[model samples]
Target: MWVRGVEWLAAAAADPRACTGDWDHGKGIALLEAGRLWDVLSVPDRLGLLTLDLLWRPGMSVPGPTLIDTAAGRVGFFLPPDPSAGWKGADLRYATKGAWVAVPPPYRPARFLEWLVPPDGTGTLHSPGALAGALRQADGALAVLAPLCGR
Candidate 1:
């Protein structure tokens, strides 16, 4: 059952119906604009995985939908429109107005891009504060482990 929210999001594409059509034909990715419905923060997969772990830890709030581009070795986290600054860096890419993201079907995984956490249909998104904190922690963890790993 396709959620109504996902249906509405698909409509934002240039050819709204293309998402479904491509899915049926086995090419399931649609380019959608960012900053309208939400903004996305693209981070390295290692950091993303660690941040996700923190976000899902006991007592922490559940995060919003996230996408992983295995081919690019990056992860995308969906956040509310026009999120505050300080989350940008070489590894942290923010997609805002005029930027387009190759979004996979919300219901399931796609080829190059797959959902790490699928949207729940409601307009829920990651809390910037929580995400930022978790990201910082993840960064620190990596920094400490890098020496031991000889990377």
Candidate 2:
């Protein structure tokens, strides 16, 4: 099933400059899939012609928040900014099972949510659970399409 998805992704990439708006965000998913599965996990957003990939992963799980390594610096997840507040900026409180945990930040937390790919360079952050989620989502889609394929 993944093989089929990869084929589709490859076809999409063959065209010069795939547009996320043209295909609902499938282009970013294809880009993420092209890399090592565990090395990249991102949610792509379309802003005009550019796509913003929001990537995250879990770090060490502890009583407090876990720290994630990013180009900017290490940022926390799960842990809230204030002990009184029940939620952090956008970090998932409880990431999927086996997900790494990151310590929560105080101000402009998502700033740590840097660009997944720089304008002129290449690199991606690896998050185990995020990768798993992407795979599962892709697989689930295949499962649904398999019946329609008549095989």
Candidate 3:
């Protein structure tokens, strides 16, 4: 069954211009074009799951956008990896401009250990629950997500 679905997605990707013009749905069509079979296979179905249009496929004014404006409202999506101790539901990382983040199954709350795995692994370690116990601390800077215009 999965193989047949993959094959269908492959066929759709072969000629996206022939698919529906719906932008949001088009993202799925585009994903089939840019993503690997394993990645597409990882997609989970939920009541209102909307995957991020992050693939550099055809018909996209912006290849990889954090969010999109749909008929319902603004939305975003992500897939978190976890097999056990997981009741994978939807999640919202950072929704700007009133965008509501959506998540499918197999992608939910990231466990603490998963968050601990940092790149390079050379950064200073902050023990979990050491919020006010730190001897020294550095001031933080305000970071913001600036959406790309005309995307």
Best-fitting candidate, scored by lDDT: 1
Candidate 3: C-alpha RMSD after superposition: 16.7
Better of 1 and 2 by lDDT: 1
lDDT string, candidate 1, 1-151, tens digits: 3466467567667676776677556577778898888889999999999998889877755678899999999989998878455676567899988889888788877788988787777777899888999999999999999999999
Residue 27's C-alpha lDDT in candidate 2? 24
lDDT of 3 by residue, 1-151 (tens): 3233223333324343443232233332232232221111112112112222123226733211122323334333212211221223233222222232222111112211111111121222222122111111211110111132221
- Residue 86 of candidate 2: its Cα lDDT? 24
Q: After superposition, how far is residue 64 of candidate 2 from its true place, in Å?
A: 27
Best-matching candidate per TM-score: 1
Candidate 1 vs 2: which has more TM-score: 1
TM-score of each: 0.89, 0.22, 0.19
* Model 1: lDDT of residue 5: 48
User: Would you list the clashing residue pairs of candidate 2?
Assistant: 58-100, 58-101, 59-100, 59-101, 66-102, 66-103, 76-102, 76-103, 77-102, 77-103
lDDT (10s digit) by residue, model 2, range 1-151:
3233223323323342352222343322222122211212222222101211123225522121123335334332221112232222222233332343221111112323422221111112333444334434544565587799885
Runs of candidate 1 with Cα error greater than 4 angstroms are none
